[model samples]
Target: MADTGDNSKTELVQELNGLLADHFALYTKAKNFHWHITGPRFRDLHLLFDEQAIEIRDQIDVIGERVRKNNMTTLTSIGSVAKHTQVKDQDSATLAPDDMVKELRDDNANMVARLKGMKELAEKAGDNATDGLLDDWTDMAEERVWFLSSFLK
Candidate 1:
């Protein structure tokens, strides 16, 4: 791993940290909806949210380590996660199941967009590893968006 230039390295770290924060936010929201969802479709949605949450959670550490591999500090606290995340938090446990699915779908869509941005940044930085990892992350988020959209249809 040769140098990526200091400025490019910093930008990549910032983007990666922001992505990491968004993933954490989305993971928590998915778990919340999984636990609070109620309706005739409870079993299907419950399982869906759990599976999505697990996938998001699994990649979180990988994102954090990517930042560390660039010799930068990743988000340290819940406060940092809240500050850096573009994903909005959902506090209502009483939201309709359909609405929950809609929100998650939109959030995952946003994540896909964000991952694309990060991929571009990685490419500009000449960081092939991060760029490749972003592809996997984008696919995961897109899959979640697809699954959540099924509920809307």
Candidate 2:
């Protein structure tokens, strides 16, 4: 594979594309939960879901751009994303608030797992840029874990 400036970034680019697909699916489901969640903590869950969805949505574009920067084609069509994403679509619009919280928390944990794996790959490729980015992404995702866990208990 050709070097992307310094590193042969094929693996990193592929990981980033996978991240984009996963996060995009998660983001949409976050919004779906935001719109449909109902329970005693309706206000709290609604706001939290909306904020997370926005954060994931913003990062989706950046992840796609990173793929392009690394000389790889990004997933654009919904079909492509569906094929690539590890995250599953929400099965119901009328989920109880607890179920919504549990589902999103699990998804965010999965995202963190991928981010950590990417960090290792980035380090191996000597792609300092990707490694640094993954650090922030991982930490932020870990915090989401904390918040969600707190909500669950």
Candidate 3:
């Protein structure tokens, strides 16, 4: 509501934190699927999951840079990610191919939703740079969701 400088900066920092947390969770879930998937679809699903995980890992760098540009510290540790992230972790040895696909699809969808919400926040803060970063991630997540969901159907 107010056009105060501190409030705008704080809002941007909070939004960045939330986005970082969600992406961290998505990245972990993708890696989990990559490690655990097995069955008739093993090769396809495994490769797909690995690619998606790497994409998320790349996004982490982009996100961290944006946070630093905003004059805030990036939450870069595993402990911070585990504490702040909303997506649940999986036991890498336990999931079947179908289960892995389903879990990753869900995580991608969730990440897309979170990024969209963050985009709105970034726009409100007049932070087009962060909004553009989220736009790229949202598209990537949606594409991954489609690819992962195809394994189930």
In order, what lDDT does every prediction score?
A: 0.91, 0.85, 0.79
What tens digits encode model 3's per-residue C-alpha lDDT throughout 13-93?
776776788778887777777877768778887899889888888887788888788777878688887777878877678
Which residue segments of model 2 deviate by more than 4 Å? 1-8
Residue pairs that clash (backbone atoms under 3 angstroms), model 1: none
Question: In model 3, what is the error at residue 135, expressed in angstroms?
Answer: 1.5
Candidate 1: worst 10 consecutive residues by lDDT? 1-10
TM-score per candidate, chains pooled:
0.97, 0.92, 0.89
Task: Please give the lDDT score for candidate 3.
Answer: 0.79
Give the winner by lDDT: 1
Clashes in model 2: which pairs?
Answer: none
- Candidate 2, run of 10 with poorest lDDT: 1-10
Per-residue lDDT tens digits for candidate 2, residues 60-105, read 8777877776667999799988988999988798888888899999
Tell me the spans in candidate 1 whose CA falls farther than 4 Å from its real position: none
Model 3 backbone overlap count: 0
121, model 2: CA deviation in Å? 1.3
By summed lDDT, which 10 consecutive residues of candidate 3 come out lowest? 1-10
Preferred candidate (TM-score higher): 1 or 2: 1
